[model samples]
Target: MSNLQQQLNFVLEIDRLKAVYRQAMVKSDNNRFENSAEHSWHIALTAQILSPYAEDGVDLQRVTTMLLLHDIVEIDAGDTFAFADQTALDGQPEKELAAADRIFGLLPEQQFIEIKSLWLEFEAAQSIDAQYAKAIDRILPLLQNINNEGGSWVKHGVSKTQVIKRNQYLEKSAPKLWQFVLEQIELSVEKGWLKPE
Candidate 1:
């Protein structure tokens, strides 16, 4: 196929991401589950809007690109809940890598490598760009849970400690956002939406 054709095919294939639902409920959608596509779009905008708060300087464009591409693998590997136990997470990286290989392979070789690299960078979360991108990624779900009265946290019986432990790296990359998260956790606990322990 021509490169354009391959790119178009890749675009069409990724449309399926919209159908891959996640655990968080959308506050405006009458509590319907958010899809990975919606999450990706939200976090891309989140990264852009929150770029100034990154602890280290980052290329906002690169961070946005990483956020947009990071979850495309969920098209095939499926969304794993952040609070899922270890058993539910076993072999998840392998599954996502395989999904990346196949789904990203649909693009022309140059585009495939470039896009896959962004996804891998986000996964690694080592670069300043990746770190900020990851901080933004975690922010939305926490907001979603808080907006929905601890949407997933309450449903899963999640505790304040668990939420903090899951998301504490935000303190390193985005201290302001981390502080906001801490306050939200306390509010959730006070509202009885999250377990005190």
Candidate 2:
């Protein structure tokens, strides 16, 4: 196949991500759960909108690209809930890596490497761009859960401590967003949506 054809094939294949439902509900959609594709789009846009607040400067374009591609592997490996217990998370890394190899390999060599690298960078969450992208990524679920009256947290019996630990990266990467998350947690607890630990 031509490079253009291969790129198109990869594009068609990733449309599957829209079918992969996530555990978090969408606030504007009558409490229906969101899919990975919607999550990707929202976070990419959020990263752009919130880029000015990143303490460490980042390339907004790179951050948006990272956010968009980060979860494409979930199309194959499946969405892993952030609140899921460790037992449910066993072998997830292996599964996602295999999925990445197969999916990103569909693109032409150069595009494949770039897309795959973006995915890996987001997974590592090490670079300033990746860190900011990750912080934006983490914010969505918390926002959705709060808006839905602790949607997944209540369902999974998640405590404040677990919530804090899960999102601690934001404290250093995006302090303002971290402050907003802290306030949301406090309100969620006050609203009886989360148990204090």
Candidate 3:
């Protein structure tokens, strides 16, 4: 097939990301559960808006691209809830690698490598751009949960410890955002959405 056909096919396949619903809800939509596609778009926009706060001065374009493609693998590997058990996440890395191969491989060779590199960078979360991307990615879910009166935390009985544990990386990437999340966690407990312990 031609390169254009390959690009088009990849675009078409990625549309399936819309069907992969995440655990978090969208506050503006009457608490509707967010899909992977919506979550990806939101994070990319957030990266743009919050780039100034990135600790290491990331490349906004790279961070946004990473956010946009980060969850595309969910189309094949499925969405894993942050609070799910290890058994649920078992072999998830392998599944996502396979999905990335099949999905990104649909693009022209050069495009495939570049896109896949962004995905890998996001996964590693080591580079400045990737770290900022991860911080923003995580910040959104907390915002949604707080906006909906602790939507997922209340529903799943998620605890403050679990949340703090999962998000400690925020302190390194964006200290202010991490502080904001900490404040929200306190408020969530006061509101009876999260356990005080």
What is residue 119's positional error in candidate 3, in angstroms? Answer: 0.7
- The lDDT, on a scale of 0 to 1, for candidate 2 is 0.87
Q: Give per-candidate clash totals.
A: 0, 0, 0
Per-residue lDDT of candidate 3, residues 34-147 (tens digit):
899988988899888876677866788888888899999999999999989899999999999999999999999999999999899899988878888888888888877887
Candidate 1 lDDT over 1-197, as tens digits, reads: 99999999999999999999999888897889999998999999988788778876778999888888899899889999998999999999999999999999999999999999888988998887888888888888888888787788889999999888877768888889898899999989999999999
Better of 2 and 3 by lDDT: 3
Candidate 1: which stretches are off by over 4 Å? none
Candidate with maximal lDDT: 1
Estimate every model's Cα lDDT from 0 to 1: 0.89, 0.87, 0.88
Candidate 1 vs candidate 2, lDDT winner? 1
